[model samples]
Target: MENLPYGALAALVGLSGGLVLGLAARLGDFCTLGALESSIYGGDHRRLRLWGIVLGTAIAGCYLAQAAGYIDLSQTLYQSVRWNPWASIVGGLVFGYGMALAGNCGFGALARFGGGDLRSLVVVVVMAVFSFITLNGPLAPLRITLFPQIGAESSQNYADLISGLTGLPPLAIALPVAVLCFAWALSYAPLRRSPRRLVWGLLAGLAVVWAFVGTAWLADQSFGEVAIEGPSFTAPLGRTLIYLMTSTAGGITFSVGSVIGVMAGAFIGSSIRGLFRWEACEDPRELGRQVTGAALMGIGGVVALGCSVGQGVSAFATLAYSGPVTLACIGAGAVLGLRHLIGGFQPG
Candidate 1:
């Protein structure tokens, strides 16, 4: 392990975590838009309830690990970056609406692409390209001008704030939150009956914890050469594409490994479930809509500094201020977009 490059080790950590997430998505039916769509229109709440299990487990696992000194939440971007409510609200809404139009978030697109959906491949590529465009390309200057991402003086998270206010340890405040999440999830009888879903939800949460812990250790060892990050599919997807195009110019990192791991894991899960069938978009109009949505997602994710999994799960795990607000806005925007599609923008 000492002989291997630090970047390679980071990639290994990302790959392991990403594989678990991919499996969770495929085998456990964990998804963002799918959950919203199912609960709102399909009259199913099991998947929505599954989110509670995932959030509860992730929150408990991450904060407990922090309390044990396994990782430092302060180093993660969610805490390190200054909190911007406007960015979270606006970016999340745009990203969520785009997700509704595209039929998936960046992470979901990768998972579906892994299942041999050629249409998803298009989404993945377009999203990656546009993410880079917004991140450092033509749109970067305007984005930065609008929502500057300066560093925070202290950790910007709910746990830290509440800890300071109550004079209690962060873990003390986080535990009950975790318990509430678990209780909410278990309250749903259908979710309780599905052992497979419960197990996978737990594993998915652990995967986020693993990323933080692993990368934190690596960052310490590497003297900050490697960033302390978790599973985020926006810029990471662009990084993977860049590495594929210019391996000589850039080295493999956690982002690259995670992006590839998702596809591989999705393929494996699809194969196991006999769901790996080649699919393509036959409608040019549908393809155009997906492309436009992907572009919006890329731009919005850049502004928000995360996709659904990034802000929804990873940031929430740390109890960051932006997490819940951003997620709520994303949900609202998704609901709006879904209604627009379902109603064809007609007055009810």
Candidate 2:
């Protein structure tokens, strides 16, 4: 432990949590767009309800760790960055629509790529390139001009805000919200029957908590050299690419570890399920659509400051204001995109 660099330690922490997330996505069918599509068009709510379990467990675990002094929520970008409602709404909508067209988010693309889907490899690369374009490339200036992300005066989250209002401890508000989420998930008989799915959901949530706690500890040990962060696929995807391209210039970090871990875990999960098969986009039109969608996702994710799993799960675990609002907008945008694709926009 002493011999390993602080960056390596952070990478290890990210790897551990990311592996669990990847496993959850593959083995448990825990996916953002898939859930929405299933619930809305497929007439199945079990996958959608699984979100309750994930959110409930994450919320509980994070707050519990906070109370125990294992992690500080304020260090996270979700809390540190000033809340931007317009950014959340607009970025989320774009990301969601792109997700619908591409058929995957960054995380999902990585997972599918791991499962030997060559098409997902395209999505991943395109998304990564565009993410960098928006994050630090040409579009960065425009994004900043439109949605300037300044530092917050203090930590910003639901628990903090509600606590301020009620004069109660943050834990007092967080635990009940967690309980409500669990209750909502368990209310679905189908989801309740699937203990495997439930277990994976719980593990998925715990992964987010693990990311924060592990990164927090590393940040302390490194005297702030290491940043406190959770799993976020958007910018991380770009970071991973940079690291891969310039190993000598770029040092190993959490983002690299996380991106690799997801693919590794997804491969394992795919092998276990006998789902590993080489696949590719045979349709030029489909490929074009996917590339375009990936570009949109990259740009939107940068503007929003997180992707679906990033905001929907990791940020939400911290009870950040950006989490729920961004998630809702993503869902709405995905629905609109899906409707358009399915000819629901045919003068109806």
Candidate 3:
């Protein structure tokens, strides 16, 4: 008896996700662009390092939850065996480059948007539209023709691939590697000094992790047969766009719900904190950054299948091997964009 209101389950996952997102967005002031801004301009490492902690905490928490029978990790979208490494890795690299170009990762894009950065709205739209086109829009056929992936019979995990590469058990590699990453990020002295920001960072990161685990659990319960979906910005942005255009055909996804919730949460938090700035861009340069960044995010997200927070951090924390690969590639691309790609876009 396949009697399940998966739709409601999807909404529940979204609600829980929004609860956590609202709390995190308000408390932490978390954003990849903000982190980069701090690193580049303020010489502060607190935010960036906290991002690492957030991911680590979430990964640890999600895994523990799964081990404790609180959730089934296998039910999520990422767990299904699908072949598309080029789409993931190469696309991740492009996405990362876009982040550099866009000046914010996925989470940062949304966070910035909520904080009254109207430019971020442009970025979000480009990201959503591009993702839709690639996922199932005009370019869908091109994806089918060009990037035909072949995954192992029932898995798309890079952990298995890592084992083959290094001849170590997947867990053995994943654990030590993740731990090392945590240590490396926290090792930065400036980041260690800002205990307050660090705490907020930890809270935000845990929220990101919790959002996914909580959703997976709800998804499982909703269908009475584990259904897996995680919190991501890309699909939700697309969903938000789609719902606007095709209201009757497809309903909003959990991802979109999380995004909307985050916005509301951020807005609420902003109002309480007196941080709301309902202003638009007067600076053309800023506008350019927003638009360019948004387009890059759109195109890059399509290739990679998610944004920095979506696939890289959130997805990777699930111990999905491709998640890490996407993260690395995205980072690499961002570096390149920052290094060589800024001058071309003139103020418009």
Where does candidate 3 stray beyond 4 Å? 1-5, 22-26, 40-42, 149-155, 158-178, 224-226, 244-246, 283-289, 341-348
Candidate 3 versus the native: TM-score? 0.83
Please provide, for model 3 over 1-348, each residue's C-alpha lDDT reduced to its tens digit, 9 standing for 90 to 100: 236455545655675666556556656666665566577657887776777777766676666666667766555556654646787777777777778767776666666567787776777788788777777888878876877544446545655567788998555655665676678668988777767556766666566656666566655555544246566777678877777678633565566567777777777767777787866778778677667666667766766656777776677777675677777787777766776554564424
Q: For each candidate in the order shown, give its overall lDDT on alpha carbons.
A: 0.91, 0.91, 0.67
Note each model's CA RMSD in angstroms.
Answer: 1.9, 2.0, 3.7
The candidate, 1 or 3, that scores higher on lDDT is 1
Q: Residue 19 lDDT in model 2?
A: 93
315 in model 2: Cα distance from truth in Å? 0.9
User: Number of clashing residue pairs in every model?
Assistant: 0, 0, 6
For 139-202, candidate 2 gives per-residue lDDT tens digits of 9999999999999997689999999999999999999999999999999999999998999999
Cα error, candidate 2, residue 83 (Å): 0.5
lDDT score of residue 252 within candidate 1:
95
Model 2, residue 13: C-alpha shift (Å): 0.7
